[model samples]
Target: MRKAAALGVAALALAAQCAAAAVPVQGYAIKATYPHDPQAFTQGLFFKDGFLWESTGQYGASSVRKVELATGKVLQKRALPEKVFGEGIAPHGDSIVGITWMNQAGFVMDQGSLSIKGTFNYMGEGWGLTSDGERLYMSDGTPEIRVLDPKSFGEQRRIKVTVDGQPLAKINELEWVEGQIYANVWQSDRIARIDPFSGRVLGWIDLSGLAATAKAGKDIDNVLNGIAYDAKTRRLFVTGKRWPKLFEIELRPAKK
Candidate 1:
């Protein structure tokens, strides 16, 4: 088993090396600014039907909410059980799927009513969750992104994330954008753009110092945790927990 895993990793590393030379991403300036709550601990962010939805973490504070983009007003919210630590979230049609930290439980909620519809079990603590219109992609604060059948929520395949032949660890929040998976490195400001086919890190979206503008307040969630992309409009939205504003920035290829 170890030998097979080693060989698989070696093959992926070689593929990353070949793709690294072609990866071109230049950072762009902030395009738009939106309202963000300074008291919400944003764990996951997604855009659906012109509304922005956020899932917050922490034990007692865990919640899923739908908010107006311009006003920062919560349209609907449902709290998690006191024992479950909420994590990432993704949208599926009219329903929302949420993962729980250390609980191994995932919930499917009514998209319009915001009520729990069903639940499933996972093997590891759920950290980040996203989908590719078909299968669900999840992270457990590890390098691998586990693909699961959306209906069953069971593991189908797994791919370890790497960039330029180096393993990228602590992959937290994930967003599937244009056939690629973008992930935030936990406790860090940068988000890596990964190749899902081979789990190679093509490049990184550096958010180092991006959170400097946010003033820390009492009981504020400090770590950056929100990421959402609008596919139809091609806009990327990002914000940290308890942040005062949501930034829509364009990605420009970093100069070598």
Candidate 2:
């Protein structure tokens, strides 16, 4: 009888510990208006020199496009061959780096002319990609980030991702901003802010209930992907391929 009581107490204590370990919600605020889109399924996105560049995906449906933010108009578009499906994209100095899903090839394109400059190879499947001025970060649908040498396109190191003792996997659509990595959880409406050095999730940006928004009612992408940051303007852009609109959001702490 005494042992049973002791076990019960221990189980209660563990439950209390788990409740205490839950990450707290601080607060939240919206910075700007949400943009609208007609076609969803955004695969890759990046902001460079006041322009928003995007890529869409599927087996045979993929493209790279430059969009005007205020108007949601495609200023320029270059469709990928049906054989090459597009993934995430980022800016490396004056050039744009884009990845091809399943093709194992990535391209460095000229920003002004939209011409391909070079191609490089990487191991595993490329799902999402981004750059942090110096090093390139990639996701292979794993709970880790593989740092690549920009020049050689070779692996430098990898760090596992976790938040509050929970492993966060299926990370897609990556963006590096202000020394941190931001990733979209595949097939969900949540974004995780991760530490670049330790791979710990610092915070989470819950995009819950976003699928029911007015724009989502029109032409919602099946899944969410793509994130981009504008350094000069401090703007964060998010979208999915075939999504009706891209959003420029200002994130605040969740409510307490």
Residue-level lDDT of model 2, residues 1-256, one tens digit each, is 9999999999999977775456543223445544545563577888887878887787667777888888878788777778988888878888888888788999888878778889998877888888888999998898988898888889999979987666789999999888899898887777888898999887778776545542455433465577889989888877665557666777775645
Q: Supply candidate 2's per-residue lDDT for 160.
A: 90
lDDT by residue for model 1 (116-200), tens: 9999998877988888888889999888999988888879999888765667788988888989888887777778888888998
In angstroms, how far off is 56's CA in candidate 2? 1.0
| Error in Å for residue 197 of model 2 | 0.7
Question: Model 1: residues >4 Å from true position, as ranges?
Answer: 1-25, 216-221
What is the C-alpha local distance difference test score of each model?
Answer: 0.84, 0.78
Q: At residue 99, give the lDDT of candidate 2.
A: 88
Q: Which ten residues in a row have the lowest lDDT in candidate 2?
A: 24-33
Q: After superposition, how far is residue 66 of candidate 2 from its true place, in Å?
A: 1.2
